[model samples]
Target: MLSPSRRRRRAVGLSLAMAAMSVVVLAGCAPGGSDPGAPQRRSVNTRLADEPITIKLYTETNYTLYEELAHEFQRQHPNVTFEITKERYDVLLQNAPRLMASDNPPDLVRLDVQTDQVKDNLLLDLDPYADAYGWDRFPPTQLAPLRVSESGQRGEGSLYGYGINHSVTGVYFNKELARQIGMNEPPATMGEFEELLQAARDAGLLPIMQANAAGEANMTYQAILNQLLDRQTVEDWIYNVPGATIDVPESVAAARRLQEWAEKGYLNSDANSVDYTSMVGRFAAGEGLFMFLGNWQAAALDSEMEGNVGFFLFPPEDAGRPAIAMSTPGSLVIPAKAENPDAAAYFLNWTLTNSTARQTVADVGGSVPGGDPGRPLPDVAPGSVTEQTQEAFQDVAEGDGAIGFLTNATPGMFQNTLAPQLQLLIGGRTSPEEFAAKLQADYEEDLAS
Candidate 1:
């Protein structure tokens, strides 16, 4: 399934450091473990009477939400302005480190590689601000992805970044297509879900819509593992905890399930040829009964298919188990050498605590509120896909069932390992055990490096 020589080459490519992270490290990310400095705490409460200041923000995501948030922030503090530079995700990844290392670094940036960037001292540790601003008011799980240890170990410790919104992954069903297949409710167990897929196939409808070419196969593969394994086991693997392994029975079983589905013709024969946008478009146009995807596609699907589409967690192995899904927070970071650290921290604090900002996050940002549960829910259109998305996020977040993305298990695992192995599996060139073994090997190699 995985060629050792090729795997070694990919590993070496990563070891050479993704070009952006290869940028010169300065001071070893807060040498000797000293604090970055106190955040601009007074700015949060003090009313700046037209005091002129501009904050530069570099981002590669959530353009609309950030644009809205910036406008609202400027509205409240008339003199505070934003110089936001939006770039493609890859371009930003390659350039952010050098830019952050420059004398006039952007005040804020949406960091995609925290573990790598933090090791270079490119990101400011936001622990002080978290303490001063009561950031713990939000669910602790919501903050886990944003925090990292002094050694750049992720999953638990000092806060490096804060998320504006959170995302969930699961099944997006076309109700109309499901009706044609005689399914009226979301399946509650693995067997029941497979029955639904079979029913759709029997009715001459494509059962699941996925683009293997764009690496969409990993979502389903991961959902299966989430169903079979407990939260802690999966978390251990993803967080790089010592002694963690992905070759366990649960993971092997999960891989087999995906292979079974592929053989049953539940997936499209041409799945390898389609791109992500086209795959979603085909699903929206009613080419398939169910689509395995993340909530990031909710807004667009709502716009395209409206009430025709509904979402649910991928069913657990046992119907009795609590539903678990792949989930994570949006990425935000402050540059270590930012010109206005206090103002940047102030904006971050406002977004997390302010009711108006939370509402915008839920409604305009098309994500659940990134604040505490006690806070009021955003007013979404009744029974809309947006409402369903928020409910899904709430269930997983409050139920302790949410887990970070599988791709996050290693820096480049998604592209270098996962995508190719899954392609081979779906194409009948690799067995399930072989597929799982390859993944475990790559994970171990990355961990060792």
Candidate 2:
């Protein structure tokens, strides 16, 4: 569990000016008269008040959770209804270019946190609305990725999306399995981690469940790169700084390390064909020693493994470097083409602060981005696996560490170009030098276009 002291410290560290702005917004909306029990007058300031509004939302969330939350939201605002649609992560990525070409795109869409399409102009800016509603309560670290430029623009003002919760990637291990293997604790360094993987293999068990079939599995590369490379190197490669290329020594070294892992049989043989959902199930069945996943998997683990999971920050490169993991805010953004931006914003703001909504997210095994809502999720056991998962996230957020996923933080055809190359390198079909050359060529072509 996150220490109460740490939470308070983080809350205090958030910008005082932002906090003051929030107070002003709340005060302006407070009832002008002295009837405390009376329903506060709806602000004339909102643009979507009584108009007929239907918001179309395109998302990657499970349909059941989406429907439940959508229903709860509609119950609060009887006049507002959402036309919700769902798709797999890859489908959304593949179709974004075509969808953006159409004038009638979904009013609300959940985009890949690390894609050029969304950063390029497919998404709408939310800063003006965010400022109006005092949504600045979220700290810079939590909000910056969704707010910054895809080209690595620093502090140039624009907000692309707002995430409902922040997600981090790390290692999920089975504690009982570790104990039975004669290892009593999680590995704390890169070398120890390698040893652990070897131990699992020696015990006739698959060491790691590396999901590599889809581009999504490349997230493991991103997580590992976070430890191996510096933040600026990440930014340069991702945003394609002039005169910089993806074939940089740091990137090549990272690719080579991944290939080495594969060569040593640390990764599962069936990795090339595994889907994320199936990979999670296999891990839950105790088929592997470690599973790399985002915090959102907490809910699935709770239902499938009964809160018996243990997580650790991805081990650092060496003792000198601070342990860090990939994290970004996953948000809801209303499109500029929406028929009801005002109503959509109202609904968005309401959900952001609603304790029940926050609880629903937490109960479903997702982590909330802002302050604690005081209600606990039903399935999340106190002082158990869920608590540890939350603590690990909070620690990364509070520390002065790098933020954003590598692929997400980078720009251009990074995933489409380098990710597949990484897959080939890991499968032993390509050497490290050959992988570097291909990455350089792809990056050059992207720049030419």
Candidate that would win on lDDT: 1
Give the clashing pairs for model 2: 114-408, 162-331, 163-330, 163-331, 164-330, 164-331, 238-410, 238-411
Model 2 regions more than 4 Å off: 1-4, 7-52, 61-68, 112-121, 148-155, 239-244, 371-380, 409-415
Model 2: what TM-score?
Answer: 0.82
Model 1: residues with Cα > 4 Å off, grouped in runs? 1-54, 61-64, 74-106
Q: How much is the lDDT of residue 78 in candidate 2?
A: 76
Write candidate 1's Cα lDDT for 1-449 as tens digits: 12333212111111111111111112223423455432232222222334799999888643467667878888878889999898755457668888998988999887644576776677877776665566777778778888778655787767888888888888999999888978888898989999999998998999998888846788989998898888898888888788888888888888888888888999887887776767888998888898898776777678889889898888887877887988788767888788887778778877856668877786666787675555555666666777677678767866788898777777657767888888888888888888888888999887666
Error of 2 at 390 (Å): 1.3
lDDT of 2 by residue, 1-449 (tens): 36666544222232222221211222111122465324332322444456556777777743234455677888876777889877765566566555644677677767644334444445555665676766666566656666555353533346667667667778888776787677776666777888888888888878788777765456667677777778666666654556766566766777787888788888888788787777887889988888888777776676677756788788887865665777766666655445555566666665556657766666564565453333232234565555567778767766755455545434445457656776788788888778777867766675565
For model 2 the local lDDT of residue 268 reads 85
CA lDDT of 377 in candidate 1?
57
Tell me the TM-score of each prediction against the true structure: 0.82, 0.82
